[model samples]
Target: MTSSLLFASEGFGLNLNVFETNIINLAVVIFGLYKFLPNFLGGMLERRRSAILSDLKDAEDRLDEASTALSQAKEELSSAEQKATKIRNDGKTRAEAIRLETEKRTVEEMARIKQGAASDLNAEASRVTAQLRREAARLAIEKALATLPAKLDERAQTNFLNQSIKNMSKD
Candidate 1:
């Protein structure tokens, strides 16, 4: 609206001419800021971008190191597993060998026992045979003594006694 004035209507009041004065001043301020603002804001944005890139680089390096550590750990685990398997196999083989050795010893011991038993049986049989021979000789001598008095005269007895004494002296 026309306030019937060419300048401000009051002391230090706003210039309300939208098309004539305010638009022109606002356009000049916007143009001046646009020219200078990029130099200041661009440096700040560039610094922030550099910081973010540096962080990403450090993260990538850390990831690579972690992957290397993981691979090394896997290798160590595999080596340990192989060693365990070797130890287990060795234990089983040793057990089998020990069992076989024990069996051999047992077999040998049994054989020795059988041999000793046979020897003892042979010795017992020989001793019994000797005893039977002595018993038979004593019985035969008694039978001869009982029949001697009826069968022989006094002179025959005297002659037999002399012969027995001669045989005993020679032995």
Candidate 2:
């Protein structure tokens, strides 16, 4: 081993006097890195894990809030739909009632008009019949007054009077 170390030292043209010191310096630097690096890296990794957990908790809370709001919105939407349906049904019922009332009024008005027309017709027919009777009686009276003096002479009037007296005695 001493011969190989001499040959290695001779190959690199380095003297054996500094080799042990260089190895000792390298060993010190390696030991220092091994001792401090794990603590620093472990502290950084732990901080990162805590930050990730906090972010996950915040995300979960937001999700819960969103779910609750969605449920409330759904309930409101259903209530609005039900109210709209009820309003529509009420409007239809009111319209139908109005239609029925209008029809009834129209029928009553028609009946009243028909009754008035019939009454007017009956009154006009009665007036016409009365006028005709009065005209016929006037014509009959005029004809009799104009011809009675010429047709009934003294002998005819005496014979008619004697026959009227005989008819009165029989009754």
Query: Which candidate has the top score in TM-score?
Result: 1
Residue 137 local lDDT, model 2: 97
Roughly what TM-score does model 1 have, to 2 decimal places?
0.61
Residue-by-residue lDDT tens digits, candidate 1, 81-169: 99999999999999999999999999999999999999999999999999999999999989988998999999999999999999999
Superposed Cα deviation of residue 2, candidate 1 (Å): 4.0
In order, the Cα lDDT scores of the candidates are: 0.90, 0.90
Candidate 2's TM-score:
0.59
lDDT per residue for candidate 2 within 1-171, as digits (tens), equals 354254575466433555654877888899988999779988999999999999999999999999999999999999999999999999999999999999999999999999999999999999999999999999999998799879999998899889999999999
Model 1's C-alpha root-mean-square deviation from the true structure amounts to 6.5
- What TM-scores do the predictions have? 0.61, 0.59
Q: What residue pairs clash in candidate 2, if any at all?
A: none
